[model samples]
Target: MVFYCQRHCYETKYTTKVVSCKPAKIDVVVDGKKKKTACYEVTFEDTILFPEGGGQPDDRGTAGGVEVVRVVRRGGEAVHYLAGGLEEGATVTQEVDWTRRHDHMQQHSAQHLVTAVADNLYGFATTSWYLGEAVCHIELHTGQVTEEEMAKIEDTANQKIRESTPVTIAEYQASDPRLIEIRTRGLPEDVVGAVRVVSIEGVDANMCCGTHVDSMADLQAVKLLHTEKGKAGKTLLFFVAGSRLLSYLGECVSRERGLNTLLHSCPADHTRLVEKNQKELKGAQKSLREALKDLAVCEAKTFLGVEPRPPAFFHHRHDGDNDYLSAIINEINDESVLKVLTAGEDKGPGILVVHGPPALVAQIGPRVCEILEGRGGGKTRFSGKVTRLGKRKEAEKYVLGALNGSVKET
Candidate 1:
């Protein structure tokens, strides 16, 4: 006998099961016309794998040294597909990856816990359960569960875990319909086969087919990721359990530390610091604009007594003194003489150099743009922003002196 249902995975379908697993291996040829490996038909003794039943995913792992590639249900028997087929008389020790099995156990039993908790607390049954990647989910049978209520349920479930309630597995055979309450959605109706039930003491009691641990503590914790409304008043609760809970908490702490370091304060300061930076940035922009205005005044003064050469150009290069440079160009906004200004911290700020009309500023503008990573266009007339002014103070003094040409260099 083999416990099998028609499915590609562990998803249980609501139909009469014909036969169950029997501990015997049989050899079968596969890919008759196509190039396929031989397969062994065998009864899996362990209950770790959830054969595709009731929308549950099929169990995955290896069997007989070959990967248990697929657990297919063909004619009410789970056809365990192996990478390499075994002979009819071959003896192999089969083992399932405990990590995967343990996780599946958590999800399946947690599904029961959730269903039980909902029914006890809110008179709701669980219609379906899905243990997906990164999260496990269950759809509540009926009624609405608010987000807060879900949180409360999650807390209760974790409380149960902390309580370390024992999980008991029992097999029963009864003709009474009340016994059917313990059967998960997809057990055979006609046959009086023994039904398996997993009970978590007072916390939960329900019929289940998947493997389970002996205690709720084995789950470690059930962390609710979120929940949302499902079809027909059903609500889906997405969650993580066991080691996944630890990993999720670790990530959360790491993120908190990262954010704290970035903000240079406690995690609470992140939001505050963002607001502070925004206000400071606006003030800094206003100050920069005002500084630009002062520099423009200085430039206008510098252009006061300039030599009236026909094609004289003024180029100002300074270290972080763009205000004066731009001011000079703006004052001499004449198309006859091109102007260029460049300044920045990368250029050491405040270093000023200027030449004009003798084709100096015009020829040097492009080279300065390349050197200082600046950009501007002009035809021997005034055009350029402070591309790089590394020496702001010295350049400002020299340009101011040269602009008036009155203050002799001391």
Candidate 2:
């Protein structure tokens, strides 16, 4: 079988025949280790699967019932990767993912129209473009574009789509005079031979190797969603075209409905309602925190006034902080007193030990860590968190023992 070097084959169809297939090894890194796996890298005489290049992803599909996991162009040849090896010179049918292909076509076509409009309107050349699954973006040569300017550009691009302008694909030799007449962002130095040009009827003539739709109408719409600054003062305009625009609109509507339900307010007044609710929540939280601080102080005073004083007491605070714990310790006012406080719900118990004698706390803090089977460090006034919730009692016992001189060091 003879293999023809028809690089533009993917521009027309979605299926073609394979010309050569061979066993190959691909290194895949799993858990930080590279493993070489047996696979087949098939080359087609005329391929409909576009390789990953030109800021567009490769086409996903299958060949001969085996999944084409990846497609790469190596020196003018499109190599299709498959886990299941195919026979060399076998005639296998390649099926491309239609949804993804169509989506790419819309996005790539939208990019060209948008780029052309921006250039024609403001002389802002497109520096780069990306066709993402959810959104597409093109970086312009300007620092930033105003909201009004972006709206104008978007309107112009969509107008072209609404006009149903024909998107023509043509190939030209490197030395062709017509090539110089076309608008291009300049081809890479390595690009040689026939250059494929995608032109949008009187709008744009760009030297692009990426696949595009047959007409601007197929794009359906081009909505410029947002713009931000990129590297070297470039302004990046994010947009959605075709079905993706519909998907984005659906999501926005769903979110608005949810917000209305939760806030019991209309979409127009959502911001005002949310801010009011937040203020109320903040005030309530402040009051609750003050009550907690008062309760902690009262509890500390009660512990201090006990008829028969113990060496230390373990207290569980629903929610405690450094200030709350310190206030409690201050009210007790006993040099020999030791207070071990814990505050947690589902999280593993955390320890905050405060003692009257700084030296004693410095010594006993590390021992508490050992007893709890956790890790911590402290200085003069020792305070550290405990991780093991189950061992909370054991940790307290060890700390109390050390304070009362009941536990001896080994």
Candidate 3:
């Protein structure tokens, strides 16, 4: 939207009503759209009322007697979209959401403290940053650090937060020491402007553009959430400050209570309780499968007498996969006269094999598999799968045919 600073700049318009939430929204044309600009944006020309351009989120507030829902940076210009639409050329006083702003200040300032302090303690520089709602992240200058090192970093950072050191903002010329220049990415070639250095007392001094408080002391507590390796061996750090710290602690406590009740144990024993449950589950699965195997062998004895001959059968189902199928095939090769049971699926499972002589098994597997689209292979001695599908009963018949060919008992 065009910024009209003086009467001469554009036709002047005024709000006859006192501006507040309830006031009738005047039709304000933003860019070309008819919408209200927030209270904070009412005074500035193209200049932004909120923070933008960095990874940090825009400052939120009210402008032009309307709620400033969001402050945004599109391309390069900063813009504020308001709740109540503004008139095409109307004028209104601006307002801001102050409490939220203070919270942001704490977060930004805490970032300064924790990052700077960690660097000093662990000798890992913060290579990059992204300021988000719940957490602000910084990429360490080095590629990676051990978990123990990260713990040390965290401990030192928190200690600094508790120390509440003063954060100083100072303007430095290009001639400033290389130490100060190291913080910002190298200056643009065309730009020869003064850079502002924000110093966190003895903790850190770096060039930064986003707003920060006067001291780390303002941050009630800086809490490190986690640290993990990133691209190029960089370490990413997540942290919370002030009110967010309190919120996190509260959530942790609630989770502990629920876990304690569910496990019927003290909080300290949660790890042991979870491990016990996992072991018990494993034991149960093993015992049930052993019983099923014994039953299957007994049932196979009855089927031994009534099959066709020389059947090299191929049947597959999903539940029994490649690993078990391979094992079954190995067993058949070792025994020559045998039955194969497999699970047929995409990966091939629930396949059945009944051994028999050549003539009876001829073309039976192919014809049966035509219904389920199952495939099998065998030499004079054995056949195995390339592909297979459903049609389990027909698959069984094919196996019986293949097996009948070989065994005289059947």
Candidate 4:
């Protein structure tokens, strides 16, 4: 449905008449499926809630006892999305989400002040901005920002907030020559006739349509959290304003206290303690690895001394790995005795290693792997791990059969 161009609804908190209302089909995701929800698309003759635009989210509240989910601006009309339908030409009392609206005002206004301060003091112009749930950020036309520079900008912004300067909204025609005196990112291509400008008295002025509080004092405060690199050599400065600042501080304090308890160290020493513990862990792991290698060498000796020379030797070891197998193979000096070693946990995957005569190695390794349903690659000394547990006997039988000429070598 088409809507006429009209004044913004947020100039004052006033009850107004509904100009139009119609059924709007919206797709909502429920249980991983899209379900169409028929809602009321409403427009008011005048309203107090701000439609989403200019990096600020839509205002939410109730209209005539019906929940308003979202508001959008097309041309001059403030479209409201309502759960239940409203009758056309109905007189409804509308209330803006005061908490949410006020929060946006604080963050947006702080953004303007901070951007102006950065441009004036550091020649860093604002390229973009975002008003997120817990934090807001402004992208500046520079790749990097130092902590000292951000601290200065934050201090200046809070100073302006403390001064409680008045903020004014004004409208001027597009053709007005006085427009040259004001600062603006630029006008939208579709904009016609007059343009609305929000001005912070004695500080800065810019063309904007989002709602704002009456004075800087209402902003409460602006805190710079950190900065990150952005597109086109830009720097994104993250921050929180007003009550969000208080909430962020509360969360940080809680985390600091929790870390002290968990680490059993003061906040100043937490990093040092963590680093020291990591070094100790690395040392312990090195010692354990060396001890395991020594054990592997001793195990290889027992199989070498066995008398009744079997066609091929098979051993099921419930521990160690390729490193252990290699250590044992390196110690077995006999060149003719074929060795098949399978090592793993009681009920887990197993590793197989075959070493000895080149012809026997080629014959036994492939046959053993085929029976166990595993894959591996090597010339004479072959190694591969099987997925099944306790299948060591099956692999050993295949190797023994190959030696007896009952199983064909691949």
Candidate 5:
């Protein structure tokens, strides 16, 4: 059966009688968390909200003043999932989200145009297509699409839009011989009744069920953003049309303006300036690493100069990374003294490393990790992540006690 949505694509509101209302639960994400929400699966005698099918998402709208979260076709019926239940046989006003509907119409119509143009120009048949939230793409049965070809396809698509080609839809029976002429991936296994064919005036015709604009002019323009390699030697052509294209252009302009302000350069010079800054950053990082290594050596020497060397040594640095801790451990190179080194913020997450006699390192490593709320294991050298760097003093005390106890046993 042809749905009310398919018949009247431009209608935003309609009054229909409720056929059925059944309690149902659906998963919905609220504030970043997914949870089951109670709703009613209500079927109307007729609906302006399109059910999801043919690679197009369902229309969002309101039924009986309640939000319709989702809609799907079950057999020959359009089921509207409403946030609230409506009385059976009651007449209710359904309002479609016009902005969303128009966006989908523009995109869906643009896909038909792009697919036709590609096939006609380069003999690339559409294998599949995706209608994403921000952008849409069609997978062409080809290995690649060159830059020159892409430009030609995009130019031709916009030219068609300028000409305002008419888009027409017609229905035919399953036994009709005309079905062989229409382009189609295949009809659904459960498809019943007539086949819907959407045709572009003198351009192309295909079997489709998605709502679309009446004319190519409604698309305003089409932009072939880029191409990516797909499975089985297919090429994915990404594009945006109408409002989505305008939104993408707006984002590009905003980013360009921000870059100009930060780099104090024009759009043409921004790339060069960014590259120079990255090179300088790499140099600065190299110098810092060398300086940190030298400082580690000096710290090790200072500890070695002590008249009476301590049994246990603890060191903490607020800024260095795990590499810096490893540098300090390598310079000391003492197997007798228990060395505990940490690097990061005082009370935040950090790295922990312990080096000493094999027996002591194994025994104290895990204990120290527990004290600092970290995890690591080793025989003579242990390294792991720690979350409680502020407990460094307590961990040091535990290590010292273990050493003193060992000495007493000896």
Candidate 6:
């Protein structure tokens, strides 16, 4: 069946009788929770709203003055999911969201042009394609697409657009002999009626049921963004067409302006300046790690110098990491002295490490972790991530009290 929207691609409004209307539920996310939403699954004798198919999303518009949230193809019918109910057999006006419809038409037609040019220049067949929210991509059967080849394909596609090549469509029965010469991925198992073939003048012709622009001129432009590796040894060519291309360029300019302010350099020198800054950061990190190691040794020496070494020693540093805390225990190298060490932000998140006699360490590790809102367990050494660094003082006092009590009993 040739849908009304497919037949009159430019039509924005149509009056039709409602063929069916039934209660339905659709899944929706509310405040990060998924739940069911009540709606009506409606069908009209004919509609100007295109249903979701052929890699193109469903059109957003209104039916009987009620917002249509979604539309999908069920066999030969376009089912519209309306937020409000419409009475069956009632006459109503259906409006198409032209902005969204036009965008889809531009992109869908551009894909045909791009696919044809790539295949003609190089035998790269389009395995699949995706019309994403922000960009569109065509997955080619080839293993890789070189930068030079991408430029050539993009140039050829836009050249056709510049010429304002006419895009025409033809419909034929499923068993027509002319179908032999046309390119097709395949038709749906449930496909009914005629097969629609969209052709770009002298460039190429292929079977497609999706809506498209009347001519290549409607595309305005095509920009090949980049390429990425796809599964099964394919290459995905990403691009934006028409208004999307303009929007993408605007975003790039905005980002460049922000980078200029942040780096105090122009776009031409951004790469060099960023690389130099990254190298400097690595050097600073190396210096900080070495200083932390030295600080660990000094802390161990200070604890050992005490004539009456405390049974339990607690140490905290707002810098460093778990490795730095472990270094202090390694430097101390004494099982008799219990060591409780933490490193990170004073009032934020940190790591905790405890090392001592086997029995004492096992008994005290879990309790200390609980106090600091963390979790860890070990026989003679315990380590874990801590979240409540603000409770450090209370944890230290509890550990010291436990060790002093154990000492008195011994």
Candidate 3 lDDT tens digits, 1-410: 21221111111222232222232334566788988533433323432244453344555555555666665544333455566655544555554455565666677777777677766676777676777866777888777667787677777767776777777766667676764445655543433345556778776777655566775667777777777778987888888887777877898999999999999999999999999999998998777566544444443443444466333324344555444444444433434344445555654433534333434434443444454554665533233443444445665665565446545555
- Stretches of candidate 2 off by over 4 Å are 1-17, 23-38, 188-192, 321-323, 326-337, 347-377, 381-390, 404-410
Model 1: residue 301 alpha-carbon error in angstroms: 32
Q: What is the C-alpha RMSD of each candidate to the true structure, in Å?
A: 13.6, 3.9, 10.3, 6.2, 1.7, 2.1
Question: For model 1, how does the per-residue alpha-carbon lDDT over 198-269 read when each residue is reduced to its tens digit?
Answer: 689987656555567778898898877777879877778777888777878999899989988888899777
Q: Which lDDT values do the candidates have, in the order given? A: 0.60, 0.77, 0.57, 0.79, 0.92, 0.92
lDDT of 5 at 291: 87
Q: Give a tens-digit lDDT track for model 4, residues 108-174.
A: 8888888888998899989889999999999999989999999999998889899998888778888
Off by over 4 Å in 1: 1-50, 54-56, 73-76, 174-178, 181-192, 271-410
Error of 1 at 206 (Å): 1.7
Candidate 6 lDDT, 215-304, residue by residue in tens: 999999999999999999999999999988888899999999999999999999999999999999999999999999999989989998
Mind giving the per-residue lDDT tens digits that candidate 5 earns over 260-349? Answer: 999999999998999999999999999999888888888888888887988877888888887787787788887886788999999989
Candidates arranged by lDDT, highest first: 6, 5, 4, 2, 1, 3
lDDT (0-100) at residue 102 of candidate 3? 60
- List TM-score per model, in order: 0.54, 0.84, 0.59, 0.71, 0.95, 0.93
Predicted structure 6: lDDT = 0.92
Clashes of each: 60, 0, 70, 0, 0, 0
Model 4 worst lDDT run, 10 consecutive residues: 1-10
Instruction: Please tell me which predicted candidate would have the highest TM-score against the true structure.
Output: 5
| Candidate 2 vs candidate 4, lDDT winner | 4
Give residue 201's error in model 5 in angstroms.
1.7
Which pairs, if any, clash in model 5? none
Worst 10 residues of 2 by lDDT: 1-10
